[model samples]
Target: MMTTIAAAVAAVALASCAGPGSAADDAGERTLTVYAAASLTGTFEQIAADFEAAHEGVSVELSFAGSSDLVAQIQQGAPADVLASADTANMDKLVDDGLLAGRPADFASNTLTIAVPPGNPAGIASLADLAGDDVQLVVCAPEVPCGAATERVEQAAGLTFAPVSEEQSVTDVLNKVTTGEADAGLVYVTDVRGAGDRVEGIEFPESGSAVNVYPIAALGGSEEPELAQEFIDAVLGADGQRVLTDAGFAAP
Candidate 1:
């Protein structure tokens, strides 16, 4: 009895040292790293949770930023398993560099919108209102996907707006408007929907001129390429498309 008890205690100690969590947990569990555009945060977060539930022992770690910034990070050797861009242009940059393991699949599309604070205090009703001198407008930097889309809208509408601030990400533009730091901001239609009642979205005809097509791909150098590919598949599949559409993203 003493010998058996001693062996059991030894086993417990060894198991305890195997991981930082539960003793029964496998130390080699896969962590799929996803670098995605900031616009995808809410939907992707939900997808990650569902993915974790569906694939035991696999967890997803997401890094969200502007599509351009994410691409720059990947180019500079960030440890990313998958890349999801808010627009095809940024995704193409990585694919052209041979950083992707497979062809990037277009997952969804989005269009621009004017996000204003509750009640639209500034009374912003159209794209022209954004160019008003008294209106403090915020927008993503021109290099960002949303910014590029906004530029296209401007060209189509034959109007120009001088924004008070140019943000790094669409999220930042939304934050400014939601927090009353700016009167209005240009962001995606999905972003305005995601913001709920914090901001009111105004649609203009010009938005249709420039739509952004989002794409996702597994990185060529991913440590767990299979897991990364599976993750991409999950995002482009029925379940993932449901979550995205529910969040206001258009089917690709």
Candidate 2:
């Protein structure tokens, strides 16, 4: 009976000595979730990896999809600490919806390019070639930021394109062209650059008429508001800018 009482007293003493900063309290407590547009996949992944390296005991969870689709998910109560959009319009929508914890900031800009299979299978030398009836084309749906930019470019160039298929994400459009499902597609220059030799990019002057501005913000009601802001700061800081520019994105 004395032995059991002594053991209980020792356990109470140990518990009383444990501080609020105990190791057990911190283990696996640092997790941040970021929802980003599909166009930002490559760079954002690199950023997340680097952030994890810099901050010990922290992990970053990323969700990549179309800007519009991501916003819709947030609206439907998906769990995320931060949001990065492919365009300002989508971020504005979220801001208007009162879904953001802070004001969104522009970080980068991207322009559309014509992506054709390697060796220019369709002989697509310019944007005009994508309009030929015989040339099968894939594009993002008009609701997507890339597709919205495509519409602006179309209006400026006075060209009407009847795509064989419209995907929900720019990556999907790129995949369709690369897989030979479509002869060509309208995608970001970064996607073409990222694809390397898989696809050839055709530059057009009209592309300058429509450019996408990417924005990011902390989401409201985040479980880790401080960590979310730190991640956002990392993205807007020098290291993040370097990674983005190296990935074919232009500085904002």
Candidate 3:
């Protein structure tokens, strides 16, 4: 009877030592790492939450950056289970390298817009206004998806802009405008919508010339390929699309 009581006491001691989120408790948990464009930050975070709620003992780790940067990271062997690029061009680089489990699915589309400080402080009313010498314009670098879209818009509008700063991601451009570091910045329509009242978005007709199509796929080297594919499916599903459209992204 003493031996039995001692064993029970030992078991209780061990149980008490096992705290919440301890290695033992998390040993069964699976983590899915996703590398996506910066513009998809808010929407993807929301989707990640929903996905975790649906799958027991699953957590999503998201890395957001410029499409070009994300592709480069994956090419350098980053441990990402999924890749969601803001443009087909960046996604194609991975496809050419055979780094994707399958063909990427186009999920959503977005267009460029001018984001100015609240109340249009610089009075940037159109794409042409961004080119004025007195206006401080910020834009994404040419290698990034948003920058490529900006170039297309410039071509369609037959204008040129000398940006005071060139950022690597659309989020950086938006940040500059919102922080008053720039008079205006070229960012995605969805980014402007996400910014809410922090910045005022200016819609121009030329934005239609360069609608960026977003694509998502599971990586070929993922250890959790099934889970990665499931996450992609979730993003393409109706509820995910609803979250995206609500954030100002268009259907692909």
Q: Write the per-residue lDDT of candidate 3 for residues 109-178, one digit (tens) a residue.
A: 9999989999997888889998899999999999999999999999999998999999999999999989
The CA lDDT at 30 in model 2 is 84
Q: List the residue pairs that clash in candidate 2.
A: none
TM-score of 3: 0.92
Candidate 2 Cα deviation (angstroms), residue 106: 0.5
Best by lDDT: 3
What would the TM-scores of all predictions be? 0.92, 0.92, 0.92
Q: Which digits, one per residue and each the tens of the lDDT, describe model 1 over residues 135-239?
A: 999999988999899889988998888998999999999999999999999999999999998999999988989999999999998999999989999999999
TM-score of decoy 2:
0.92
Error of 1 at 30 (Å): 1.0
Candidate 2 lDDT at 234 equals: 95
Question: In model 1, what lDDT does residue 199 have?
Answer: 93
| Lowest lDDT 10-residue stretch of candidate 1 | 19-28
Badly placed stretches (over 4 Å) of model 3 are 1-25
lDDT per residue, candidate 2, 1-252, as tens digits? 999999999988887677667755675568899999998999999999999999888989999999999999999999999999999988998889998999998899999999999888788888888789999989999999999999999889888999989899999999998898989999999999999999999999999999899999999979999999999999999999999999899987
